[model samples]
Target: MRLLMLGFNHRTAPLELREALAFDNERAAAALHELRQRYPASECALLSTCNRTEFYLARPIHDPPTIEHLRSFITQQTGADADAIHTASIHREQEEAATHLFRVSAGLDSMVLGEPQVLGQVKRAYELADGCGAVGPVLHRLFQGAITASKSVRRQTGIDQGRTSVSSVAVAFAKNIFDHFGDKTVLAIGAGEMIKASLASLRRENPKRLLLINRTQQRAIDLAKQLELTGTDHGGRAWDDMDSLLIEADIVVSCTGATEPIVTESRFKPLLKKRRGRPLFMLDLAVPRDLDPKIGSLRNVYLYNLDDLQQAVEATTSGRRELVNEAEALLRGHIDRCMGEIRHRDIGRLVKQLRQRLNDIAQEEQGRTAKKLASLNGQSTEQAVEDLIAQHNHRLVNKILHLPLSQLDRSDPDASMGFYAAALRRLFDLKDQPDMPMDEASSDT
Candidate 1:
């Protein structure tokens, strides 16, 4: 088995490049379908968020996909600039890929360290890929192991002691902007988990008004009820009225699942006159960015995207240094265990192939021997003699398999069993060659 991971994160790429490559749920599902079409024998899962966009793949070691292929695929799917993708990409293979994923799932690599939201994001990504039938044994095992490691870290350490998510950091930024929210009108666009988390954090600040608007009004209404925003100052509003609400909003947080910008310069430029130059604090927390980049240029507007919030969140990583170290150690242990399991699984596949090949050979020879004996005797064999012959054939096959099976089972830390497995495959011609005809391949016993 071989694993490949190629993508960019907040540390390696700018927000513009990351946003250009980010995949929402629908886009991610479609990309997975395309990947399957392009590489049927391979497995893939895509994990895309505001801070990162990653593609994880599993293929036969002999049939690996190159970094260039992944770059081309992502560019084609997202229509991102090829040069930007190439410049910002970070590639990992085999165990390194596994380790990266483990760290990501456990929130060790998040912009806000030990953030709980990324673990859920990882699970959602795995579920989405699995639902699309893009995940096979390798990814299923890898993601599940990563999730288990994440849960273990959360349970074992105090890494999540204080405000530790992007939403919380956004809230912190809001607080720094305003001494209090009593006089401010807070308008949150879209009702995703991140928006809800941000709103929840803001609710504690006791904003004068909280308004939520979503493309699907029902979701906004449901979220409003869940957050208990039943008062006159807080409630769910219709999508058609969002523009008017935006004009009145003093603090705006927009995080939607939209693939394109919802608030553009042209749309908001006309609304600026209605606000009469009142300061607007807007946060665009969505991955394809619900708010347009050009809107940040407008006067009397303080705009912040994910990258800006990342800078502000970095300073809040105090008091968790020891916990972060402990989490990393735990993640390393998990990575080692996961890699060991993958190796065993790979070896098991080879062992099964060898056993089936030997069994097929034995069965074919036994059939030939029985036919020859019958022809020589010119009579059918008795049940007792047939049973005796079958027992003798089983004993002979076991004797032939014993030495190689024993060698495979030998534990040698200095030696790689992969070498032995590859030798066995080459020696027996057990794995079909690339040039071999499909119909001519030996049938499994």
Candidate 2:
């Protein structure tokens, strides 16, 4: 089987493109099924997140559905422009595909380098595909390897030692402003993922209270329940109560989906007197910015947007460059080991085929010998003698295989082993099995 990975990530595509291609769990499940239908024997998975949308496929090396076929499928599925996708996406095959997945699972390709969430995301994607019967042996091994490699890299390197996520960085900045969250009230104004992540990071500080509010009050309540924000002190509140809550809130994290700013300066400036000059730290993690830009001008209002959070993340990442290099090397080693195992599996299959072939030939020759002996003597040989002859043939076959089998057992499961397996297959006239493509475009349509 050949592996093919095609994707658009933060570095390769704009947010609009990523958003357009993004798939929720239900959509992802449906997409996997559709991909299976389109390429009946192919194994497929779709991984869609805020900053990326990737498709990983494993199929016969000479299959009908190639990279272009997959691209067309995606275009039809998502209604994205073919030319735009072609320009923004990347295509990788075989080892390159595996390498990219390893990087992604390890958060090397994330906007916030070494972020932990991508590992879970990768696992979830794999599970989703597997659940839909879109995963086979090749994908099962590849994804499992990626997940394990991610863990190994994290355990071996300092890349994930500190706060790496944007949400965590925002919380770290909040720490710089406030000595502690023990007496502080944190009001999170949204039920979106950014708000949820920010709330999770903030929860570690054990804040005095967490107030959740959304345009839809029930959504805020549902979010509170999902986050396990129990107790009367940490619960959802009405959107209309936001103004009153703002007076008591020491920190406000807003990441709503509104096209315009949710907290305008005009609406918030009058509430400042109620605060009595107390500092209010605000983090705006929304795409269009939930907090108005002018809110930063207000006295004692510390406003930081997504760009600010990204800067903090970048600063943290910059200091870990050496650690990242170490992580990269670790990932490469894991990939090598994984590839070796796959090659070893191929060799094992070939060996099984060889053993079966030899056994079939032995059985055929035994029947022929029995017929000739019976004809020569004009009587059938005794059952005991026939059984003895059969035992001898089995022993002879085993003896013939002993040296090669022992050599194969001792051989390292590396490129050299792959070469040996190929040579043996050719020598024995065994059925040809496709290895992962060597050429970058070998699996192209």
Candidate 3:
């Protein structure tokens, strides 16, 4: 079977297109089912997230589907047109596909380089596909190898060593504004992972109080309960009370899923008056942003969005670039170790069997020649024995060389086969070298 990894990622596609094709883990199994139905002979797995949507497939070797066919399948399923898929997709087969997946699982291919979330995302997608019977031998091997490489990268390199992700980076930025977090009231908007991650960072600071307001009441309550149970001062309220809470909060972090700004210039302009000129820092981590762009222009207001945080992210990434080289070396070591083990097992067995077969044929031919000489010529025992031994040795040498010569004469060769052929040439004195011996008999007529 041939492996195929086809996908559109943040580097290739815009955020709008990526979000349009986003699929959560809860829907992953169903997506795998759809993929299997479309290509029954193939084994498939789907990985989707905010930045990427990828299909890892294994097709029958003889009649594999084209890259265009896979792209069309995605376009039809995701409601994207041909042009949208055309500019934002790449397909890699076999070795290249494996390498791409290794880099992805290592977080090397992430929008935020070396971010830990992408590996977990891939693990979740892989588990769901396997649970749904969509993953076969090749995919299981492929993902397990990738996961193993990811683990090595984490342990062997410093690429993921610092405060990573937008949430954590935003929290780092917040520290620069506020001298101490213990006196601050941190208000978090929405119940999405961005807020959850921000809460994690804020909790680490031991903030005086935590406030949560989500569109869903229970979600806010759930987060509040979780924070309270973890020994953090916390409370939750309906979304309507958000404006009033904003007045009390020293720092506000919001990442909601609204298409438009939830906190506009008009809405927030009045809150500034009630606050009595207390400097407030707001971190907007949402895509399409929860806070209005003009909010940054307000007096005594510090606002930072995802775009503004690129300098910090780039600084962090630049530090990790050196570690990336070490991590890549570790990953290649793993791949080579695995491929070498498989090659040894398969080729070692074949070599053993072929040597045994050649020995049997050589012994049979030697017996036939000895019997014919005894039957027809009636030669003296000593001379006949000597002739038979010399001829048998010559025949064995010629027979062993037949296949090697055939392989060497081929104009083009498979990579694996060519390796073996070159090895044979070196093993015997077969190459055209100054020190090589000629194939002349030691004892002859």
Candidate 4:
């Protein structure tokens, strides 16, 4: 069997280029159907996510899909330029294909290293391929192996200690400080990517109230509406209300690209008193410091600046490097087990062919012997057929074993062929059977 994996990821292409080649659920199903029709012999699975698009293919060794075929199929489905797609693509074959899949499934190759969402995305893709009937023996084993490897890596490593991204780390830190999010109020500053990621993570926790304030009032309104948190007095407000907003908020995530500190200690000190000593967790994700550094030391106030977050990023980044080596060592063990299974399964086909060839030869010899017995002995047709059928069983076993016997006999005086003959006899269970030996039954043939 032949196996191939090809794809592009966040590292290999830009977002605009990735979007041009992305697939929705309906498109994914249609793409599989079209690929099956074009190459019926090949089993195919496609994994498309925000960060990557990967295709896994399996077929007979002689009928493997060419690189040109992959390029054409992608171009047809996504309308992406062939040359551009080629430039961004990564291709792997056989064992290397399985290795790449294992790494990706384990989230080692994610845009944000060790991100957990990728495993779920990959699982959904595998389920889709199974539903489409595109997963044959090779692909099925490959996916199962990848899943096992990923699970092992997660269980064995500390890669998921933090959420692995600045925004996600901010959410994790917030979660750690609060006992529950049911009554928490989150005031998000700036409507940018980091803020959006933090909002998405918070929404999963189901906070009581979410507020948005931005320099551009309309941008805040738009984000509030997008999050379905738009309301008269609760959702969107102008940046001028920062002092009043901080007094009511339990958590604040600021990601605006400001040149100077906006939330000074003097401006925030009065708000802390108004908060009645209630704890407030503030995350400063912006460059040039959105909040003053002195504000961090205030009573009932916990502020994590950009420098703090950077330290976290540096720790996780360095930690991931050490853990990745451990993960790869663990993955190799799983890959070896999968390769062993594939080798055993591949032998099944050859065994079937060998048996079928031997049966055909025995039937031909049976028919010839029956005709000769009828012509010379004047035997009835039924009697001749019954006699020949018994002989056919004997001939089948002998013919099946003829090659091993011949190889055993034509040997040098070194006696090496003796061991070969012993193995052949054991393989056919000739010693344990009730039937006479081929060498002893001289006239039976």
Q: Point to the candidate with the largest TM-score.
A: 1
Please, what are the lDDT tens digits per residue for candidate 4 over residues 82-196? 8899999989988888888888988787656666666877888888988988778888898888887898888888565564776667877886789888898899999976777
TM-score of each: 0.81, 0.65, 0.66, 0.58
The digit string of per-residue lDDT tens for model 1 on 61-116 reads 88746778989998888788899889899999999999999989888889988788
Clashing pairs in 1: none
lDDT by residue (1-445, candidate 3, tens digit) is 6788899876787656765666656655777888788788888889886567899998777665668888887777778778988888988987778878889999888766777877888898898899989988778778888898898788777576673777778878988888888988889998877678788888888889888999997898898777563344677778999899889888999887765789999999999999999889998876556888799999989998755565577677775666778877888877666545534554776689888988887888778777866775655687777787788777777777776666766564553666776687787757755643445433331
**Candidate 1 lDDT for residue 94:** 95
- Worst-scoring 10-residue span by lDDT in model 2: 406-415
Task: Let me know the TM-score candidate 3 reaches against the reference structure.
Answer: 0.66
Looking at model 3, report the run of 10 residues with the lowest lDDT sum: 436-445
lDDT of each: 0.87, 0.84, 0.79, 0.79
- Compute the lDDT for candidate 2: 0.84
**Runs of candidate 1 exceeding 4 Å displacement:** 358-445
Model 3 CA deviation exceeding 4 Å by range: 163-165, 175-184, 190-194, 204-208, 215-233, 246-250, 255-311, 337-445
Runs in model 4 deviating more than 4 A are 169-197, 200-319, 377-445
| Cα misplacement distance, residue 422 of candidate 2 (Å) | 12
1 versus 3: better TM-score goes to: 1
By descending TM-score, how would the candidates be arranged?
A: 1, 3, 2, 4
